[model samples]
Target: MENKTRTLYMIPYIGWIILFVVAPIALVVYYSFFDIHGNFTVGNYGKFFTPVYLKMAISSFWYAFLITIISLAAAYPTAYLLTKTKHKQLWLLLIIVPSWVNLLLKAYAFIGIFGAHGAANQFLDIIGIGTKQLLFTDFSFVFVSVYIFIPFMILPIFNALDNLNPSLLDATKDLGASKWTTFRRVILPLTLNGVKSGIQVVFIPSLSLFMLTRLIAGNRVITLGTAIEQHFLVTQDWGMGSTIAVFLIIAMFLIMALTGFRRRGA
Candidate 1:
C-alpha cells in the first residue's frame, strides 16, 4: 500500500520520463518493422546483415574501439598526474574548457587542421617532407574522436583518484610495497570502476558520431550513423534507418548495463 501510494505520488515525474524517453524509443521500435512502403516486415533488418552493413558495423566498432583505447591511454596518465599536483584547479579548468565548445565547431576546426593543403601539409612543406592526406582514413576519424572524448575519460578517473584517501598510499608504501606494486594492487582496483565508466562514455558516443565523420572524415568514411542518416534523410528509406538506429540504441543500452554490473561486481 505504501509503495502504491509512493508510485502514485510520482506520477508527474514518471509521466515526464515516459514522455521524453520511453515514448521516443517505442516509436523507433514501431518504425523499424515497417519499410518505405509502410508494410510490416523485417526485410530492412535482413538487408542489414548483408556484407555492406556488416562491414559498416565492423568499421564503426573498429574506429570506436580505437578511440576508446586512445582515450584511456591519454586520459589515465594525465589524470594520475593531476592527482599529484597542487594546481589541480587549473587542470580541472583546462579539461572543462574544451567541453564548452560545440561539437560541430570542434569537428569543423579539425577540418582546417587535417584537410589536404591545410596547416599540417603547410608544416610538412616547410620541412621539405611533403604532405599526407588525413581525410576519411581511420586515423583521421579515430584520432579526432579520441581528442574530443579525452575529457570524458579524464573526469571519471580524476574523481576516483581525488576521492581516494591519501593515507592509503602512504600506508602501502610504509608496508614495503613499491609505488608500482601499491598502484597495481590497491589504487588500480579502487579506480577500475571509474575507468570502466569512462571507457563506456568514450565508446558509446563515438559509435553515433555523424557530423565529425562527415566533416573531418569526408566522403571516404562511412559508419552506421552515416548509413542511418543517409537512409532516412537522403535515400528516403526510413525502415532501414530505423533498423540501424534500433541496433545502435540496443548496443548502447547493453553496454551501459554491462558497465553498471561490472561496477557493482567490483
Candidate 2:
C-alpha cells in the first residue's frame, strides 16, 4: 500500500515532465530536421559547423567558463564566511533577495548603472577620472552575467558548507595542519558536491544568456543564445534555430555529465 501511494504521488510529476519537458524536446528535434515546409534535411545541423556559428559556440563556452570560475571563486569564500556568521540566515536571505526580482528587470537596472551618462561613469567623472564606456563591452557582459547567476552559485555552496562537520576542522587542526591545508585537503573535498551543483546551475544558464548580453553588451558580445534568437525570430529560420537548440541541449547534458551530475552505472 505504501509503495502504491508513493507511485501515485509520482504520477503527476511524471506527467508534468512528459508534457512539458519531453514534448518540447521532441518538437525541437522534429523542427531541427524539417524545414518550414516540412521537408526533411540535415543542412540545418551542418550549418552549425560554419565559421560564424562555430565562433559563437566557442565564445559562449568561453564566457560561460569565465563566469563559472569567477562565481566559484567569489561564492566559495562568501559561503564560508556566512557559515561563520551569527546571522547567517539573514545574510543568506539578503543575498538571495535580488534573485527574486525578474532577471529582465535586473538587466535593465544595470543598463542605467553602466550607461555612459549613468552611475558608473558619472562616479568616475566626479573622482577626476575621465568617463569610460562601461556598457557594451566584454567586461560589462561578464560582470552582469556573474551578478545574475552568482546567487545560484552561492546557495549551493552555502548549503554544503553549512552541513559540513565541524569536528573535521578540529581534527585537522589538532594534527598541526594549517588553516589553508585543512581547507585544501578536508573542507574543500567534502563540499565539492555543492560546488558541482552550483556550477551546473550557473554555467548552463550563462551559456544561453540572451537578454543580459543584449542589454549589457549591446551586440558587442555574441553567444550561442543570441544566434538562436536571431535564427528563430529575426531571420525566421526555425530549422536552424531548432538545430542550435538541440546543440545547446546536448551541450548542457555534456556539462552535467562532466560535473558529475549524471548518474553512474545507469
Candidate 3:
C-alpha cells in the first residue's frame, strides 16, 4: 500500500515533467529539422558548425567562465565570513535579498548606476579619477552577473560549512597543521561538493544570459542566448533557433554530467 501511495504521489509530478519539459524539448528537436519555409532540411545544423556560430559559442563559454570564477571567488569568502557570524542566518538573508528582486529591475538599476553621469562616474570624479564611460561595457556586464550569481554560489557553500564537523578542525589544530594547510588539505576538499553545486548553478545560467547582454552589454557581447533570441524573434528563423536550442540542451546535459555527484556505494 505504501508503494502504491508513492507511485500515486509521483504521477502528478511525472506528468508535469512530461507535459512541460519533455514536450518542449521534443518540439524544439522537431522544429530543428525544418527550414524557415517549413521544408525539411539539415542545413541549420551545418550552419551552427560554421565559424560564426563557433566563435559565438567560444565567446559565450569565456564569459560564463569569467562570471563563474569571479562569483566563486567573492562568494566563498563571503560564505566563510557568514559562517563565522553570530547572526549568520540574518546576514545570509541580507545577502540573498538582492537576488529576490526581478532580473530586469536589477539590470535597469545597474544601468542607472553605471550611466555617464551616474554614481560610479561621480565617485570617480570626486576621487581625482575623471568620469569615464562605465555603462554598456564588458566590466559592467561581468560585475552585474557576479552580483546576481554570488548569492547562489554562497548558499551551498554556507550549508556545507554549517554542516561540517567542528571536531575535524580541532583534529587539524592538534596535528600542528597551519590554517593554510588545513584549508588546502581538508576544508576545501570536503566542501568541494558545495563548490561544484555552486559552479553548476552559476555557469549554466551565465552561458544563456540574454537580457543582461542586451542591456548592460549594449549588444556588444553576443552570447548564444542572444543569438537564439535574435533568430527566433527578429529573423523569424524558427528552424535555426530550434537548432541552437537543441545544441544548448546538449551543452546543458554535458555540464550536468560533468558536475553531477557520484552515487553512494557505486
Q: Which candidate has the top score in lDDT?
A: 3
Q: What is candidate 1's lDDT per residue for 137-188, written digit by digit as tens?
A: 7688888888889999999999998898989989998899998899898899
- Compared with the true structure, all predictions reach lDDT values of 0.87, 0.91, 0.93
- RMSD score of candidate 2 (Å): 2.1
List model 2 lDDT by residue over 1-266, tens digit each.
99999999999999999999999999999899977676899988888899999999999999999999999999999999999999999999999999999988988898899998999999999999989999999999899888888999999999999999999899998999998999899898888889999999999998998887788898888898998898888988899999999999999999888987554341
Candidate 2 ranges beyond 4 A from true positions: 262-266
Better of 1 and 2 by TM-score: 2
lDDT of 2 at 92: 98
Query: Which tens-of-lDDT digit does each residue in 1-266 have in candidate 3?
Result: 99999999999999999999999999999999999899999999999999999999999999999999999999899899999999999999999999889999999999999999899999999999999988888999999999999999999999988888989999999999999999998888888889889999999999999999989999989999999999899999999999988988898889888887564231
For model 1, which pairs clash?
A: none
Instruction: Order the numbered candidates by lDDT, best leading.
Output: 3, 2, 1
Error of 1 at 170 (Å): 0.9
Report RMSD for candidate 1: 2.1
Clashes of each: 0, 0, 0
Error of 2 at 175 (Å): 1.3
